[model samples]
Target: MSENEHSCYRCGDDLPGHARAWDYLLPDPVALLSDEEQDRLIGVRTEQVVTASGVGNFIRVILPVPLDTGHTATFGVWLCVTSRPEWQAVIGAARAGGETWSGYTFSGRLATAVAPWPEVFGARATAVAPGPGLVAQIRRSDERRLARVLTQVWPDSEILAARERGHVPGVMTGDRPRWRDWWRRGRRKTH
Candidate 1:
């Protein structure tokens, strides 16, 4: 096989050139909320940290799913903290970097609904900080299905299906915009 070509481990079939990583801007709870409600509840927001009055404290994390193509699918997700102290502790470890960050582990519920596995939403998860300049990694989950997703290798077809679902417009399962619509809008002539 060529360097660019990859075969699936399960079926020995060619794997498509689908993206190996996906990112979510915000947790499903926040994303589902109206703009006005989000603005009213969210007190402090940043690229990695989200603090809301009634909602909860959230931290960006990474969930790695192994694919049959010997590639890992990385999902940038969010973990909800139950209290301010817990949030602060996690944040402090992340900020400290090096050993402190790498050794830190925390438990929280997943705030993001991953595509093709929206059932994993709100599942209890344990995340460990990888290191500086990297988000925490979801090491384990209480939900059986989600635990399997995290530990077992999945067929490339499954990953591809998730990618396809993520690209569809008006699809609530995957919170992604349809790029084709933007291109069509750009081509339309204005009066």
Candidate 2:
């Protein structure tokens, strides 16, 4: 393989390119709800904010996980806020730009589960704004596995395998894809 070409660490097959980051369209809870329920409860839905009468408010943020290959995999997840005012405060800081977000932080539960680690769903997390125009970053998590994912560098093979598994449904809706399906496909390709 050429130096610029990327390959799957698990299957030893040439990959199209480096792994790309993915974003969840909605929080797991909202996404799981039926269309009618979502329409009835959600008052305002935007790319950055989601306000629901019974479900609470959510703000989009990025959770960046470091990969061993020096590339970072980012997941566009949502953080659920307890109140409308708290949600507004985070949006304000994010838009104010410059050092306005300095020292600003908020505590909330992760609304979306990362495809690679489904256990992170609804985990308690603390987020901080990196700067203006940038989404909030998950600085800490109460869940041990999620905390490690935030702090540690993961093997490229694991990440690549996750990327492959992400194609199957239920990656974001809390229904985990079966491992056998992914393994069988990989084996088929090799043969």
Q: What is the C-alpha RMSD of each candidate to the true structure, in Å?
A: 12.0, 11.0
* Stretches of candidate 2 exceeding 4 Å from the true structure: 1-19, 83-85, 95-98, 167-191
Q: List, residue by residue over 1-191, the lDDT tens digit for candidate 2.
A: 65646665546666556564667788766786679988898998988788766666788888989988888877788877765577788767767767887657887777776767766765668888776566778889877867988989988788778867762222332254332232222111221
| Pairs of colliding residues, candidate 2 | none
lDDT of 1 by residue, 1-191 (tens): 34545565546666666547667788766776689988898887887888766666788899999988888898888888765677789888888888888858998777776877776766778998877667889999877967988999988788768867763211223343332242222212223
How far in Å is the alpha carbon of 20 misplaced in model 2?
3.1
Q: Which model scores highest in TM-score?
A: 1
TM-scores for all candidates? 0.75, 0.72
**Residue pairs with clashing backbones, model 1:** none
lDDT, candidate 2, at 123: 68
Worst 10 residues of 2 by lDDT: 182-191
Give the Cα lDDT of each candidate. Answer: 0.73, 0.70
Candidate 1, residue 106: CA error in Å?
0.7
